[model samples]
Target: MENANVLIVFVSAILLFCIAFSRLITKAGIPVLVFFIFAGMIMGSEGAGGIYFDNASAASSIGNFALCYIIFAGGMATSWKSAREVLLPGALLSTAGVMITAILVGVAAHFLLGLTLMQGLLLGSVVSCTDAASVFSILRSNNMNLKAPLAPLLELESSSNDPAAYMLTITIISLMKSDGGGFFGYALMFVMQLAVGAGLGFAFGFAGALLINRIRLNSDGLYPVVAATIASFVFAAVQLMRGNGLLGVYIAAMVMGNVKLVHKTSLVRFFDGFSWLMQILVFVTLGLLVFPSQLRAVWLPALVMSAALMFLIRPAAVFITLSGFKYPLKAKLFVSWVGLRGASSIVFATYALTEGIQNADTIFNMVFFISLTSVIIQGSMLTPVASMLGQLDKEDKTLVSRSFTDYEEDIQGTLYELRVVRGSKAVGMAVSDMKFPESVRIMLIKRGESTIAPTGKTLIKEGDTLMVTTGKTEALLALKERLALV
Candidate 1:
């Protein structure tokens, strides 16, 4: 009980400090996640707080769980519409690009770190892919409105790449422990693990979405809880089966997000807030797991590897993989800089520790140090990079100038997002009696930060944004019916 209380107070103080000084930190071009982790280090085992936490197992478990939550949230956050074009390229990049990155960096690490080839590969495997929590947090906070392919590409890559990295790391760790093994056996296991993980993730994601849609509770507060709980389950079940829990969680979120689920908007809001909470929890806990005293042993190697990742390995991967993609040099450079490692690298470092590999502590400390440097040095400069590339704030002008080139030429009826006018009408009418033409359907309504799919019995209230899709002939009639101004 005493420990729990101290934990709460310590976390609360750090969170308060973060909130109070977020703006100043951003201006300094330092990502706040780095500071959150640093705060944990200061108040943790090595710092003045004297917490004495060194449980790699516990840290790994929480970090993995937090990652599941983060990935699933990313899945739910994906727009099936925007994802259409970028799907193939992104998936290819995630799986194949990860393979190339690990191999390339592993070779580089072998010579640079003077370790066994397997150890170098293991290090590469752990940090090869981008970490989602860091990328998502920075992108959203900075409000970097990327073009279609750019946004979805990054989103898809980070969300899906981890399972591959995990599989590679474990395989190499096993090889290191067992003094290497038969290629065929390892290949079989690898293929089975990936197939099972992807398959389960898809099934659970779809099923969970359907289940969420069917469960209509009497109380609104219970809704978010139910959705969040189910998302966690989606992750746990798949992972328990040795499948890809991250993939499963994300797939589940995508289903719930797009399909007409009960309180879709509420679910989005709830998960988003929960994701932020998880981010705080993740960084803090992982931060506490590090001991400053032990890091000095590996600081030289840490600096060497960090330098290689920044100047050579990362740029090489970007240039090689994205050779055919139409991204300008500036965008490519920004992409290279923004591969900020955060909790996931730290978590993978913990995974390495649990595997009992030689130099495990060195890997953990090196990754922890590198993650800090990446977020602090590269992440906070995202806005400036975007501004340099001229990609920042392009959306404001695009919104004004966008045309419905894909819509009907003639207004038989129009799909419009309606903001209910005060004193005009639609105050308390049952939707069925509103006399909106049969051609028109009030597809969805955004009311006071909540999105609702209205049925015939649903009430039409003022100050609501009704997304009504209908025919051209009934357009005026629908407006008249809404306003009762006929």
Candidate 2:
């Protein structure tokens, strides 16, 4: 009981500090994720906080758990219509691009860092995929609006590309444990992992959407809880079935997000906040897992590797994989610059340490250093880079803008006024008789400039302006029908 209380207080304080300081960090043109990570390092065992956390296995577990929420929330927020525009490009980036980046980086590591081919490949794989949490948080928090389909392309690639990186890391680890396999064998494994992961992801995603929309729980609050539990189950079941759990959960959330569920507004809001919490937890826990003293030995190699990844390798992958597409040179360059390695890379590095691979400590430290470098360099410069490449959107100055802004959390439905004219069935009807959609609320009635707080018994006469607080589609459709419009 005592320990639990202490844990609660410690975690609460950390969360509060991070949340409170985020505003200040964002104002300074820095990504708040950097602050969260730095806060963890400062509070770590070697730092002032003296909180010791060196369990690789435990950190990995927490990371995977956090990823479930992070990925799902990302999917839930994705606009499918926009995703369709960049589907082909996003697919290539997430798959072929990952392979190219991994292989090239692997070669560089082998030649420059003096590691074996397989070990170098393993190191490459650890940091191959851009971490979605860091990317999304930075882009959104900064209110960045990229031109055309670039935003969705980046989001879709980041959210879906982790499986490729994970597969490569694990495959290389398997190769290291045994004699390396033939080309055909390795290729087959890659195809199977992707095929299985994607197949199960879509299947589970569709099923979750159907289930959420059909099932009606007694309480609205329970809907978010139910959705969250189902998402976690999707991940676990996929893993058990030898598929990619992260991919499955993300796809599932995307599916659920598109469908009209019972309490969708609440669900999105819940997951949005929940995802941020998980990000803080994952990054901080990763920070605690590392000892700052060890980073000194690998900083040089880390710097070279980070530069190779940010410049040569990532750009090559983006350009080569996207050559067939019609995107402008600027758009492609912007995509290359957005390749920020983050929590997932660090999390995967722990796999090396836990598996007892050769130079696991060195691999972990290098990955940690490189990920930080990516965040500090690429993350900090995303807006300016996009601006320099002429890819930043000029119309919207807001930190973030969603296509479906009405459905966004913290944004209330618009207060719209609808007038009931002649030739309307609602010409002499009571507000209660109109039977508005459950989501629509009639807030006031304006008859001859006499503003009235409408009650169910209030009559809605012709020329009356009904002030409503509801979604546009629901309110407009309901008003059209109620007013007997042709």
User: Which portions of model 2 miss their true places by more than 4 Å?
Assistant: 1-11, 396-400, 403-486
The RMSD (Cα, Å) of candidate 2 is 8.5
Error of 2 at 186 (Å): 4.1
- Tens-place lDDT per residue, model 2, 1-486, is 997788668767876887888877765546677777877887899977788988999998999899888888888877676688888999889889988988998899999999888888999899889988777777766767678777778888998898789888887887787765566786687777667767887887777767777887787788788888888898899888777777778777877776665567778878889988898888889988889999999999999999999989999999999999989999999999989999889989999988999999999999999998898888778888888999876754322345322243332587777778788888778878988876677766777846665555567777888777776675567567766743
Candidate 1 at residue 209, lDDT? 70
Every model's TM-score? 0.79, 0.82
Residue lDDT tens for model 1, 92-167: 6677777777787788778988877877888888888787766765665554556544666676677767778777
In the predicted model 2, the residue pairs found to clash are 143-399, 143-400
Query: Residue 86 in candidate 1 has what lDDT?
Result: 72
Clash number for every model? 9, 2
